[model samples]
Target chain A: MHYWRDGILALPTTSHYLQLVILWSIPINFLTKSYEFMLSAKKIIKCLDDHWPVLETLVGRSTLGSFSFQDVQALIQRHSPGFSSEQVFREAQRLLHHEVLIPLAKSSQLELNRAVLEFIQFLTQEHQLGTVGDIQSRIEDLDRLRGKLKAAADTKDVSEMRRFIRLMDERVREVVKHFRKNESAIMHLVEKAKADDTKLSLAKRYSAVMEAFDEYIEPVLQMIDINAPFQHSMQALEHQLSELILNIEQTGFLQSEKEPLVQLRTRLLDMNQIGREALIRSTDVLMPLREELRKNTLISRNASALLAHLRKKGLEPTLEQLVPKFSSDHQKFSLGSANQITSYMAELVDFQDEAYQMPEQVDPGDNANIRVPDLAEVLKSARVQKANTDLSKWLAKSYPQLPVDELLFLYQELSRAPTLKLQHLEQYSTLEVNGYRLTLHPFVPTATSGT
Target chain B: MQIELEQLTQLAEIHKKLSTGYHVSEQDFALWQELDTNEEAYSALFTALGNQLKRDSRGYFHFDVDDATVNMGKISRLFALTTYALVEFFADQGQDPLRALFEVEISHEILASILQQQYHLFEQLEVFSATDLKREVMNRMLRYGFAKAQGEHFKLLSPVYRYLDALMAVDQLAEFPGESSTSSFTSNQEQADV
Candidate 1:
C-alpha cells in the first residue's frame, strides 16, 4: 500500500496536461501517428483517472482552481464511491476551516455558501428549474461529494481527511473571493433597480392623489355656492374659538383664560381682514359682469329694511304697503305668495267671514241709558211704507220744478217733533227741487224708559 | 255558455296542471269533450263571451253574468291562460318571464311561478307586495321595465312598449270574433264568483 502510494505520488504533474490533451482529442484509428499521441494521452489519462482524488486535490489548488467546500466534497464523492452525504458535509466543513481550498475567511465562505444555496433554491422554485435535467444532475453530484467528505472525517483518516480538508479550504477561499466580487456588483445593480421601483411607486401615488382630488374634491368645490366659502370659514373660526374657550375654562388658569380671549379677538380681527380681501376679490371679479345685480342689491337692502320693520312690530303689513316703492322695471321681483304680507296677515289674525255665522239681534234695553244708538235698529227703522209712499210719489210727480235739497229740508223740518215715531221717517220718500227728486230718510229716536 | 264553461275548465285544467299535477275535473272534461265536438256552437258562444270581455272607458272589462255579459270567472280563467301562455311563449323566445313579469303589472302567484322557474328572483320575491305589483305594472306601462320604488310611486327602467303591447293583446283577445265590429264596450261591472 505504501509503494502504491509512492507511485501515485510520483506520477507526473504533466499527467493533468496529458489528460487535458486526451480530453481535447478527436476519435482516431490506432495505426496513425495521432494514435500514438492518443495512446500516450490515454495512459496519462488512465493514471490520473485511477488516482483522481490526489490529482483533484493538487489541480484544484494549483490549476483546476479552488472550489467551495461543497464543490470539493462533490469532487471527492465523484472520484471515490461509498461516500455518504453526511461524511462529505463534515469533511467539507473541516476543509473550509483549514484554508486548503481557497484563501477566503471562514465566516465569509459560510455566508457565501448559505446565500448561494438560498439563491439556487429561489431559482429552482420560483423559476421552475426542477424540470431541467442538467441542473438536477449537477445538484445531485455536488450533494453526493458533500456526503463523502463528511464520511472521511468521521472515520478518522487524519492524513487523507487533512488533505481533503486543505483542498476544500483552498477551494472555499477562491469561491468566496469570486462570490464577494460578483456579489458587490449584483448588490449595486439591485440597489439601482430598487431605486427605480421606488420612483415608479412614488409617481403612481402622486398621480392617484391628484386623481382623487380631481374626482372628489374639484366637483365638490364647484357645487358649493360661492357665498358658502365665507360662511364655512366663519363657522370654523367660531368653532375653534369655542373650543379654545372650553379648554381655557377647563384649565382654570385666570391668565390663560385672558390669553385665549385675546387670541380669539386677534383671530377675529385677522378673519375680518381676510373677509375684506375676499370681498375685494369678489367685487373685482363680479363688477365687470354684474352691474344689474349690484343695482338690485340696493333695492334688496330697502326691501329687507321694510321686512325687518314689519317683523319687529309684530304686524302683518298689507301687500299695498309692503310692495317696494320702485318703478315696475326696478320691482322685477320673484317673492313667493307664501312670503307675501297679506297671506302673513291672514294667517296671523285667523279671520273668518261673518256672513257664514248666525246673525245675533241686539236688545234696545241694554243701551237705553247709555245714549248709544243701536246700529242694527237704525238700519231696520228706515223702511218706506207703501200707503204713505203714494202721497210722496204724487208730490215728486207734481213738483218737478222745486229744488230737491230745499224740499227735503222743508219735509224734515215739518216732520220734526218731541216724540218722533220710527214709522214717520218713511213719509218723506221723494222731495222735488230744481226738477230733481230727493228721497229723504229722516232719523227718529225710539222711546226708551229713563234708567 | 258551454264554450265559456269549456274555456274556464281549460283554465282550471291548466291551474290544476301547474298546482297539483292534474288536468281537469270529470264534469269539466266531459263539457270540454262535448264543446270540442261542436265547433260552430263553441265559436258562437266564444264570440258572445268575448263581447262581454270588452273594456269600458275605465280600461276594465265589465263581465256581468246577469246582463248577458261575459261571466267574471270565465274572463278570469281566460285571462289566466292568456297570461300563462304569454309567459311561456315569451320564455320560449329567449325572454325571461321574471324580467317580463317585473316589467309589467302581475300577481304574486305568477311572480312566484317565475321565481320558482328562475332561481335568481327567489331572493327578491320576499320584498315585493300587491301594491308593488300594481305600481310595477303602471311603471312598466309608463316607463317599460322595473322602476326604483320612490315612496309609493315607481319609475320605469325602460320605455312603456311592453305594457302597451300586453294591453293591446289583452284588449284584442277580449274583443274576439264578431265583437271586433263594435267600437264601444261596457266597463266597471262587479267581478263574478271564482
Candidate 2:
C-alpha cells in the first residue's frame, strides 16, 4: 500500500498521472532494480518538458513500436535543431538511463517506457481506444478477488483481506481511469474524422468512426445496461463488500478492516458512475457523425449508381415507371365521365323547349297612320293657306286624321324644316285634335318663300 | 377516426393542393403546422376519401396515385431525368448532390448550363433549351410544390428526396437481382406522395 502511495507521490500534477503511477506500481515489486535506476519524478517531468516535441511525435506514432537509437536521436535533433549531435546523443542516452525509454530484452530497438507513454498520452489527451474486453477482464478479476476476500474474512485472515482490498482498489481506479481516457480518445477520433480534409470519400473518412461505434460504443452500451451482466456483477460485488462491512460492524473483531472495505465499496460505486457517464458522453459526441455519414453515404452512393444506370440503360427505360408519380390533374383532359354525361342527359330528357314565347306582337292596326305626311305637301298647303296664320293649327287641321304622336311628329318636322320660311309665334294656343289636347306657340309662315 | 372540425381547418385548401399534385411542405407554414399537429386525423380522413395521403418523415404531405396520365408520365420522366442529371452535375462539380440540391439555388444561368451540358439526355425528353426545361419541368416543379421560386432562381424542397429515393431504389434494382422492381418502386411511389 505504501508502494501505491509512492506511485501517487511520483507526480503531484494531474490525477490522471497519479492514476498512471498507480497503474505502473502494480508491477513495480518485481522490477525494483529498474525502479531504483529510474529518475526522480521532477527530473523526469523536466526531461519530458524539454523533449515534449520529440515525445509528442512518438505519441503520434505510438502505434509503431520500438524505434532504433538512431531514430530516437534523429527525432531529438529534428525537434531541437539547435542541439549539437553530441547533445542529441547525450539526451537520448539520458532518456534511456532514466528508464523513460526502455530497451527491449535482446533487440536493439527502444520503446517509450509504458508509464511515460501513458503519462504523455494523458497530457496530450490522445488516447488509444481500449476494447470492452479490457474492462470486462478486470471486472471478472474483481469478482474472483471478491470471493477470495470473503474466504479470508471467514477464516479471519486479516492480512489476506487487506491485500485483496488493495487489489480491488487498484482495479476500480484502473476502470475509472480507462473510462476517462477512452472518452477523450473518442472525442479525438470524432474531431479528427470531422476535420479530416483529405480527399477520402465520405465512407473512407468515417471508417474510424464506424469502427469506434461497432467496437466500443455498442459493446460498452450493453455492458453498462442496467439489466446486464456488468451491473449484476457490480451489484454482487457491492453486496459482498457491504455484507463484510456489516460483519465487521457487528463482530467488532476487525475495526481496521472496516475502513478499507468501505473505501472499496465507495470506489466500486464511483467506477460504475464514471463508466456510465463516459459512455453517455462518447455516445453524445459520436451519434451525429455516425448519422451524418450514414445518410451521406446512402445518398451519394445511390445518386452515383443511379446516374450510371441512366447512362447505360438510357433515361426512359431506366426511369420508366420508376419515376415518382404526382396526384396529377389528369381529369381535366377528359370531356365527361359516363356518369356525368348520363346525369346531364337525364336532365335533358325531362326538359321542355322552355316555351318559345314569341314576343307579343302588337298588330300595327294601320300602316297609313304610321306614315308621315309628305313634308313638301304640307309645306305647299302651308303656302296656299297664306301667311299670318298659326302654322301649327293649319297643319293640325290638314293632318286631322293623323294620330297625336304622328301629328306632333309633323309639327316638330315643320318647325325644323329648312325649305319653309316661317315665324315662331310667342302666344300659346291650346288646340284639341285626335282626342288629345296640344298646347303650342303657333309659328306663322313667312310671306316670302325665299328661293 | 373522429377528427374535430378544428383539426381540419386547412382541409379544403390541403385537399385542393394535394389533389392537383402539389406537395405541401413546411414552407406552407400554416397548413403544414395544421397537418403536423393533427397528422393521424388528417391521414385517416384522406384515407377515407379513397386517397393514400402520406406524410414523409422529411416533413411534407401529398397524395399517392397509382399511375400517372400520359402527359403527366412524360413530365414525371423528364423530372426524374432532370434530377438524376442534377445529381451528376453537382457531383461532377465536387459538391454534395443532396446538399447542393436543397441549399443552393439553381438560377436560370445554372439551369442553362445544366441543360447545355446534358443536351443529349434532355433531348430525349424533348427539352432542347433552358426555356423548354423551365416551361416543361422547372415551372411544373414549382407548380407541383417540388421547389419554391427564389427570385429568378429556385431551390428544391424535401419532396425532391422522393427522386433521390427513386434514384437509390433504381440503382439497387440494377445492382441486385430477385428484388421485385415494381413493388419496390411503387412502395417508394407510396413514399413518393410528397
Chain B TM-score list for all models: 0.21, 0.86
Tens-digit lDDT string for candidate 1 (B1-194): 34445544444433222121111222234533543455345445434422112222312211111111122222222222223333432333334543553464444454444333222121222213434434333333222111344455443332122222333332221211111111111100100100
- Candidate 1 chain A: 10-residue stretch with minimal lDDT: A323-332
Identify the runs in model 1 with alpha carbons over 4 angstroms from their true place. A1-402, A411-433, A436-451, B1-89, B92-108, B113-194
- Model 2 chain B: lowest-lDDT 10 consecutive positions: B176-185
lDDT of 1 by residue, A1-451 (tens): 0011112343224333332333233223211333222234444334444444533343313212234555566765775667698866665554443322333455333222222222222221111101112222332343343445446545734455445434433332222222222222222221122112122442332332233233322333332336644345434544544554564477663333345344443434443343233223323322222222111121222222222222222222222222111111111142432224444565669866566666786765522353322323322332222113333443334434334543454345424433324234554554445545456564433433111
lDDT of 1 at A388: 30
Candidate 1 CAPRI-style tier: incorrect
- Which candidate number has the best DockQ? 2
lDDT of each: 0.32, 0.72
For each candidate, the DockQ is 0.00, 0.15
B51-157: candidate 2 lDDT, tens digit per residue = 67888999899888765666787888888878876775565455677888899898888788778545656777888889999889889999998999998888889
Query: Could you report the Cα RMSD, in angstroms, for every candidate shown?
Result: 42.2, 25.3
- Which consecutive 10 residues in model 2 chain A have the weakest lDDT in total? A1-10
Clash pairs (backbone) in predicted model 2: none
Instruction: Report the C-alpha lDDT of model 2 over A1-451, residue by residue, as the tens digit.
Output: 1012122343224445557676466436524454545457788778888888787776555454567889889999988899999999999998887777877788998877767776766665555677777788888899899899889989999899899999998888778777776776676565455433346776676667777788788998988888998888899999999998998899898999899889789878867876776787677657756765233344554554554445334677777768888757764345453323555776788888765778988977674555577877876666566534676677777766778877787788877776567777778988998677888788766656532
